[model samples]
Target: MIDLLKEWIINIASLVLFITAVEMLLPDNSLKKYSKFVLGLILMTVLINPIIKIFNRNFNISVYSQNISRSIYDEDTAKSIEKYKEESLKNTINNFENNLTQIIGEKLKEEFNLSNNKLEVKAEYVTQESKFEIKYIKVGINSGKVQKVEKVKVNIGEKNIEEKDKLHDDIKSYLSKELKVQEKIITIYKL
Candidate 1:
């Protein structure tokens, strides 16, 4: 409660300071003749700014809580999976990460016309039951706009390795079409 109060006080104080600075910048005669203009500026700063901030805060809080809940559920499920307990699983996951990075880098360069230096890629593997699920997160810079791509689940089952490869290829094809980049330029991470 105290922390929330402190934050509110700080935000209100900042808004007041911002409004006062703008008021001070105007010519003295102008402010005197057009006091209504000063009142309008103050109203916008004090009312609209806080309303916008409230909506932003609400959105962020909901998003953060949802992510936290999902992560907790995933961790619990992973703990019960037999494959995740095996020592070899770690090495397999590491190799998968390396492979995904290379693939994603190549794809980004070809499909999105992205430079290798401007692409950021991250991949991780999450296990459920006997299957491995890959998650890929990528950011590509093209013409100053940062395009973000995420694939939440890619199945890599031991008996379906060929199918998994096909899925990966399909993802590359889809991203190339959607992002208007060459299929070679899109990067896929194992995560």
Candidate 2:
């Protein structure tokens, strides 16, 4: 077992030295990144190969090495990887938007007693900020039925309840502050 560990360490050190030498020889250009990425993957495979062998005595590193080399230079494989990355990013963004809407809806319902709520959150990657930024938020409320005054109002000294217009402002203000968005970018409407 100690011999095996020593052999793995020697192999990894030699690979690292080889990779560094090759990286030094590589010209600084767009293709350098691809070369480095492939080299890094190869190094990872080398690092994991010993562990794999420990578990499966019949495991073949040569086959995996050949496959990795074959796929590394394949243009179709590169394009497919790029496409997969794009699709993954889109799915993540969609999930974030859905989750944000649900959370905001629940918060409004709990805080403002606003039900039948709809929310639209538009977000985009901001390169300057190095993060995703919310472009705008649109909230729609569907519970806008005015109940009939069941009795005549005879009390002249009682404070009136907060109005719906104030409620709209409050919701907008709350969302703007909570989301770190401008009030102008947040639109609240009755449906």
Cα lDDT of model 2 by residue, 35-151, tens digit: 999999989998998999989998998887799999786999889999998897788778878888888999898888888887899876665876777777888877758756555
Estimate the overall C-alpha local distance difference test score of candidate 2: 0.84
**Clash number for each model:** 19, 0
Candidate 1's C-alpha runs over 4 A off are 1-86, 117-129, 142-173, 176-191
**TM-scores of the candidates in the order shown:** 0.28, 0.54
Best by TM-score: 2
TM-score of 1: 0.28
- Residues 24-136, candidate 1: write the lDDT tens digits: 77677855557646756655655554455666755454576699989877956876675666656777777766675566557666765555434343334554555544444
Question: How well does candidate 1 score on lDDT at residue 6?
Answer: 76
RMSD of 1: 20.9
